[model samples]
Target: MPSAAGTLDWLPLADHLDLVAAPVASAAALVPRARVARIDAGLADTAAFCAAYDVAPGASANCVVVAGRRGGATTYAAVLVLATTRADVNGVVRTELDARKCSFAAHDDAVGLTGMEFGGITPVGLPEGWPVLVDEAVVAAGDVVVGSGLRSSKLLLPAADLLRLPGARALALSRPA
Candidate 1:
């Protein structure tokens, strides 16, 4: 673990956490003693991050933001998938959100809501009422690498505990990528 006074420049995960809402502290307060890792490599892509970090495919989780549209308004919901698969976003998310149209939010749009850079956003500190869909594969993984509320770090936690966050819900709603 880096020191409390460690430098966060070039560290998206660490820098964002320090600048954004109390995401890390909130997790610790709720889950008790959670530790986040600051990695030197970019975790922007599931495949690349796993290969660079030597993390097994089954151990990685892909966090995605999907735009939910009803009439002319759009809202965003989060979907968590096993890195080995893609979120069945079109099928499950559209239906779940009651959206007439749905698609992935642009990188900039996602970062705005998350206050974290791309590849490192987590559902932990998102606005309440934004649904979080967790693929069953992630639930069964036991542990996962989720965003540290920042772009350069990852929160390592038991998968079950991730579901305890305010809006997290485990669902069997993704297909192999």
Candidate 2:
């Protein structure tokens, strides 16, 4: 598989990610040419990771978990937006989730539910009931880098493949950062 640089040793995502994320990553890998790269956990955050690896910020994606509540019922979603944009949680996302209010998921709740570290949450391994809301811009970026469910690795795959994952839906769900 093609990689950003020889610095990233491309490998099957299932081989490098945590148990909770492995199966999903493995499934995503079935898309032709998908690749994953192991990196320092300390650099998992988008800005640092992109800079350290010489990756363009515009080509990297961020997955953020959000929670919404309505009539005492809570709903969760995973939003995928390019690094250059921010998910429209208060507007588009709230409407899509049919919730009265929406906000980023709490760190503890996110980690506990996803079984992944704070900085490495990705849509690939999310719970079955949660929706994966992907920004239309992400799909147009071609190959993009995303979290691997562990702070120590990142998945690199075509944005088109991401849109194909189960529960994924594309929308104009982002605004400039």
Would you estimate the TM-scores of all the predictions? Answer: 0.82, 0.89
| Number of the top-ranking candidate, with TM-score as the measure | 2
The residue-by-residue lDDT of candidate 2 on 61-105, one tens digit each, is: 899999999998999899999999999999999999999999999
Cα lDDT, model 1, residue 159? 78
Relative to the true structure, how large is the alpha-carbon lDDT of every model?
0.70, 0.81
For model 1, how does the per-residue alpha-carbon lDDT over 124-164 read when each residue is reduced to its tens digit? 77766788888888989876766666655666656787788
RMSD of each: 5.8, 2.9
Question: In model 1, which regions exceed 4 Å deviation?
Answer: 1-27, 41-44
Model 2 steric clash pairs: none
Range of the 10 consecutive residues with the lowest summed lDDT in candidate 2: 14-23
